[model samples]
Target: MHTQPAPTPTHCPYCALQCGMQLTPDAAGEGVAVTGRADFPVNRGALCGKGQSAAAVLSRGVRLTGPLVRDPGTGRLAPATWEAALDAIAGGLARTRALHGADACGVFGGGGLTNEKAYALGKFARIVLGTSQIDYNGRFCMSSAAAAGQRAFGLDRGLPFPLEDLPRTGCVILVGSNLAETMPPALRYLTELKANGGKLIVIDPRRTRTAEQADLHLAPRPGTDLALALGMLHLLVAEGRTDEAYIRERTRGWAEARAGVMAHWPEYVERVTGVPVPRLRAAVGLFADAETAMVLTARGPEQQSKGTDTVGAWINLALATGRPGTPLSGYGCLTGQGNGQGGREHGQKADQLPGYRKLTDPAARAHVAEVWGVDPAALPGPGRSAYELLDALGGEIRSLLLMGSNPVVSAPRAAHVEERLRSLDFLAVADVVLSETAELADVVLPVTQWAEETGTVTNLEGRVLLRRRAITAPPGVRSDLEVLHELTARLSPGLEKGFPVEPEEVFDELRRASAGGPADYAGISYERLAADGGEGVFWPCPATDGPGTPRLFLDRFATEDGRARFVPVAHRAAAEEPDAEYPVYLTTGRVVAQYQSGAQTRRVDELNKAAPGPFVELHPRLAARLGVVEGDEVAVVSRRGRAVAPARVVGTIRVDTVFMPFHWGGAGRVNAVTNPALDPVSRMPEFKVCAVRVERVG
Candidate 1:
C-alpha cells in the first residue's frame, strides 16, 4: 500500500444534513476516524454517532466484491467472475422477458444515489430494460411533499427557503420531524437562530429529544397531525392573520381552504388531535403574528396515509401568511435521504423522466429522448409506483433490479417484501456491500462505496456538493455506474457508447439531459463543478454567468397563471387506526446512531456498540401495564407481521403509543410489523402510525 496521506475533512454520505467530517487517513491513504469538522452550514461541523463513525462502514468487514451468485441448492452466495455472472444474469433476464414480456420486469432504486448515478439508472431502466415499473425510495420520503408542492406551487425540493432563513423567521412550525435525531445539523440552524421572542412549535405523538427544545410541543393523538394543522389554519383565518393582499394576488383556492378551516375550528381540532384548544389557538396566534413564518416537515409527516393532505395544509400555511418565496418564510420538507432532491430531479421516480420533466409531458420526454438518442414516443412509462411494483412481484414482475437500496429491510411490511422478492425469477442487487436485501438476491454486484466513488449529492438545503474520491475501490468492487453500464450493454446493443467510462463524463450527459428543464441543471457542466471547488452550487444555476439560486420563492413562484394556488386540505386520519385488539400506535423512525436499515452503520462496530440492537420504547404506564421492564424482550405484532425486540421503558411517548427505530432488520426490523398502506395520491406508505399489540416474552 502507498504511504498514508494527511488527514482531511469530508462530508457524510448518509443523510441530507451533509454534516462535515474530518477523516484521518491511514498509512494506506484510506479514510479513518471520521470526525466533525470546524465549519459547516449544517453542523458547524458536529457529528452525532452516525457521522462520527461513518468511515467504519467502508471498512473491509462486510464489503462484497465481484458478482455474487446464490446457489439454489446450498442457498448461499458465492463469488462469480464478472463475465460468467453477466451472462447468467443476461440469459435469465432474456428468458424471463420472452416468457412474461417487458411489463414483467421491474427496477427499484433510492435517493442515496448520486445525481449522475440516478440519471444513469433512469436511462438504463427505460432505454435498456424498457420497463415502466421503476421507482425509488422517495415514494416513502418525498412523494407527499412533491405532490403537495406541485398541487400548490410548481416545484418541489425541501425548505422553500434556505436553512439560515430560520434566523429571519418570526415563527417556525416543525410537524412530525424529529430534528434532533434525524437532522441535528438542520436543528442547529433552528436552535442557534431561534431566540429573541421567536416561536418554535413541534407536533408529534412522542415528546422526543427535539420536543425538549420546542416552545410548545403539541403531542397530538396518533395519526391526527392533519387535524391539528387544519385547526391552526382555522384559528389563523379567524384571527385575521392571513395576508389577504398576497393571497388575492398569488393564490387560487383560498376561498375553499378558508371555508374548510372555518367549518373545523379549534373545538373540532381539539377533539380529533387531543391537543388542547388553548395551546392550538396560541400556536395559531403565534404563527399569525409573525411577519415571516416557515412550516417545515420531514418523512414523519410525509410517510403517512394522509401524508399528501397534511403537506398540502403546510403549503396553505405558508401561502396564507404570504411568506412563500421569501427568505426564512415558506413551506419546506426536510428531505431524508442524502440525494433526495437529485433523485427526484433525474427521473428516478416512476412517473418522471430525466431533468425534472414529467413522463406525460411530451416536450420533456422529447428533450431527454433526443439526448438519449431514443424515440420519444417509444418510452414506455408513467410506471407503477414502489408499492404497486413490489405487490406485483410474483405475477407480472418476474425479474427485479435493485440498486443502492435495501427495500427488504427498509420498505414497509418487511415480511411481505422479502417474500415478494424471493418469488422473483431473477434478482440483481447492486450495492457496496452485501446488505440484507443483497443477501436475498440471485446476483449481487459489488458496487463502489462513498469513499471510493466520485460524484455529487444535493443536500437538504438545495445545495449540490461534490463527493470527491478519497480512496480506490477494493480489488473487484466497481462503481454502480460501471456495473449498470456493463449490464445494459448486454441487454441493449448500440447504447454502449452512451455510458461513458469516466464519472465526470457521465455527469456531463446528465447536465445536458436537463437543459432548459424545470430544475435547470443544464448549465452545470463538469468544468464548472471542478472550478466551483468543494462548496455547494445551489440549483437553478441555469447560466454559467448567473448566480445559482440559494433560496427559492425569491420572485413569485413557478406556478400556473403566475399565481400560487392555495391547496385546500381536509383532515383525514391515518389509513389504519388503533382499535381494541391492536390498541397502541407504533411509529418508526431513525436513531442517532444508525442510518436507514443499518446497511452502513451496522457494519461500523463503534456505532453499533452505542446502539446495539432493536429496542421498542414504551411509556412508563404502558410498560408497567404490559408487565415489561426495561431490557425485556417482547413481541410486537401488527396486521402485517411480528418483531421480537427489547423494550426500553421511557416517558417520552404518550401512554397509547410506542416508538421504534427503523434501523434494525433481522428479527427486530421495525418494518416487520409496520403498515404498507399508501396515500391515495402519493402512494407513500403509512410508516408513521400503525396499530400494534405488545406482549412480553420470557
Candidate 2:
C-alpha cells in the first residue's frame, strides 16, 4: 500500500536536528511518510524516534476544530463563530485595560514561535498593550545558560559546531543532562564522541542510559552540583592543569576564580557534594587531559537553587582546561524545548528583546526601538522572572494574555499558579488543543499545530530551517500571528502591516528587526531561504559571501575586552535537603516518549503506550523500607502536596532519593510539592531536589 514519491525537501519536527526529510505523501492524500535526505547538514539519512513519527502527530485525534467560548452566564463551553469569539475577547481586554492600568496587564508567549510571530508579538506587546510585564516558559529552561554563557564566553548556542562534529571531540562531560531519555536523537553525538576514544563523564544523581555509556558516573547528592563543580575546578588548579596563557591574556577574573575554589577545596566540597576525593580528582584529570572537549548541562543543573552558579561552574571547567571556543570544545547548555533558544532571543523572556539583547542596556533598547518604530523609553526594561511573575498575579497583575503556554500546570508551585490565574480580572489563552490552563481562561483562541503552519525555528545548533506546511489547519483554527493582528487593530499603537495574511511577510519584519542585534538576521532574506530550499543555515550568517562561524571564538570572543573572562563560582546546598520528616530527595524529569506535561504527546497512540504515566522510581532497598512492591501505588509527599503512583524499583538511583517524570498533573503536579526556591544567579525556580516522603497508599 506504500508508494514513494520523487525528491522533495522538508524539515524534521524534533530535537533541533532540522534534518532534511523527503516526505512522500499518499498521492490520493491520506497520510505523509518521511525519509532522511542525504544532504541535510545536521543529520544525514538518520531520523530519531520523534522525527520518524512526526507525520503521525498530524493524524492524531483531538485537535481543536473550532473556536469555543465559555458562556459567561451558563459557564459551559460551546462551539462559537470566530466573529463572536473575537468580539468577546476584544471587549473583555478593553474592559480590563480600562479598569487597570496597562502595566497591570501582561502577555506570555512560547519559545516555539516562528521568527515572524516572535517579532510581531514583541511589537504587539510594546505598541498595543504598552506593558513591560512580558515573558515565557523559556525562563524556566535556558535563561541561566543564556545569561552565564553571554557573560563568560560572549555567545550562547546549544552546539557551537555542527552536531556531527561531536565525533571530533576528545572528551564530553555531560553535567546534569539526561540526553538519552529527553532527546534520544541528540544522544547520537555522544555515542560518536565515545567511539573515537573520547572519554564520557556523566554527573547526575540517577544512573541513566547516558550514564551507562559513560566512562565514569558521579552520583552526587541532589542540589550539590555546584559543590562538585567547584571541587573539580579545585583539582584542576591544584594539579597545574589551569590554562595559564588563556587565563592571563584572555580572562579578567582568574585571581577571583582561584581564590573561590581555594576557599572551598577538596575537604569542604567532599562533605557537601558527597563525592570521594579520589573520584573527584580523577574526573578533573579526564576533563583536563582531553585536548578538545565539550561541556553540556541542562534543566537538571539549571533548575536548582544555584542554577546559574552551577552553569558558571561548568563554564569554569572549559576556562580552566583551555577547551572552549573550538569545535565541540565549548560549554553549551542543551536547550530543551523545540524553539527554546529562539523563544528567548525575541523578547519573550522578562528582561530580553529579540536578538538576545538585554532590556536594561540602553543601546539594546535603542536598537530595538528603531526596529519597532517607537521611542526607546516606551519599551519597559527588566522585570520579575516566572516564579515571581506567578506570585505577583492578582496582587500586582490584573490581566494576563497567554499564548501557547500552560502556566498553571507547567510552573513551579502549581497550586499557587492555579490560584493566581483564578484571581486575575481577565485572562485569555491561545492554543490548538484544549489544555488544563486554557479551561480556566476567559477566552480560548484556537490555533494551528506544527505541521499545519509554515515558519522557521532555530535549532539547538543555531541552524535556522523552514518549517513547511504539509496540510491545512483543522477547521476554524487560525495562526497565532493572525489572531493577534486582528485583536491589536482594535487597540492602540496599531498592528504593523495590519493583519498580515502571509507568513513570508511576517518573517520579513523579523529580518529587519534583527538588523543590529546579537542574533543578526539582516542577511537572511525570504528570497534566499526559498533559493536554498531545505538546507538549514546557522545564524550570524550575513550572506552567501560570509560563511557562518561554524564554531565561535577561534581566537577572540564577544566580551567587552575581546577576551573571555573566567568567572569564579561557589557551591551552595539545595533549598530543600533530606530532613527527618521528609528524608528522601525527589528529582523530576521527562521520559523519552512524552514531551512536556504530555499535553500533545499523551494523545499520540504510540508515544502514550511507550510512556503511559508517571512512576516513582526508587532503589530496591528504599522500596523495601517502605514495604512497597513493583506496580504498587505509593504516596509520595513533600512540603506542598502529595500524589500516589506506581512504584518502579530499580538499583540505578541512590537509596536516599527517588525519581519521577514531571509531565503529569491533576493529583500528579510534582511542582505542587516542589521547592519554589529561586536560584540567586539565574532567578530560575528549583524543580529538582525537593524533600519528600514516600509511603504505600494502602
TM-score per prediction, in order, is 0.97, 0.96
Lowest lDDT block of 10, candidate 1 = 526-535
**Candidate 1 clashing pairs?**
4-27, 325-553
Q: Report the C-alpha lDDT of model 2 over 1-698, residue by residue, as the tens digit.
A: 64554534667655545667777677656677778877776666777666677777666366677878888789877788888877777777777678887767778877667766766776677768777778787778777787788778787777667676777888888988887887776677788887788999999999999899899999998899888888888888888888888777766787888899887789888888778888898888887888888888888788888888888888887887777766567777788887887777777777878777778889888987887778999887676777787778887878788887777778888887899998987777888677888888877888887777788788887877777776767668898887887787666534535447577887776776666677876677656665674665678775555555567777778887888877878876788888899999999888888777666666677877888788889999999989988999887898888876899999999899999888877876676777789877678888888899998987
* Each prediction's whole-model lDDT (CA): 0.82, 0.78
lDDT, model 1 = 0.82
Top candidate on TM-score is: 1
- Which ranges in model 2 have alpha carbons more than 4 Å from their true place? 1-8, 493-499
Q: Per-residue lDDT for 1-698 in model 1, tens only?
A: 47767655457888887776666667855447676766656677677777776777677766775788888789988888888777777776778888988878788998899988898888888888788889998788888998888887888767655677786678988888888888766667667656656788888888888988888899987788778888878888887888899898778889988888777788888888888999998788778878777888877778888888888887887788887876668888888888888888887799988678889988998889999998998798688888888888988899988898988888999889999998988988888778888888888888887777778788877787777676777787888887777877888876878987578888888878887877777667656655764556778777877778888767767875767887777887788888999989998888887888788888888887888988899999999999999999998899998888999998888898898888888889889888988898999999899999999987
Ten-residue segment with the worst summed lDDT in candidate 2?
492-501
lDDT at 503 for candidate 1? 80
Q: What would you estimate as the lDDT of candidate 2? A: 0.78
TM-score of 2: 0.96
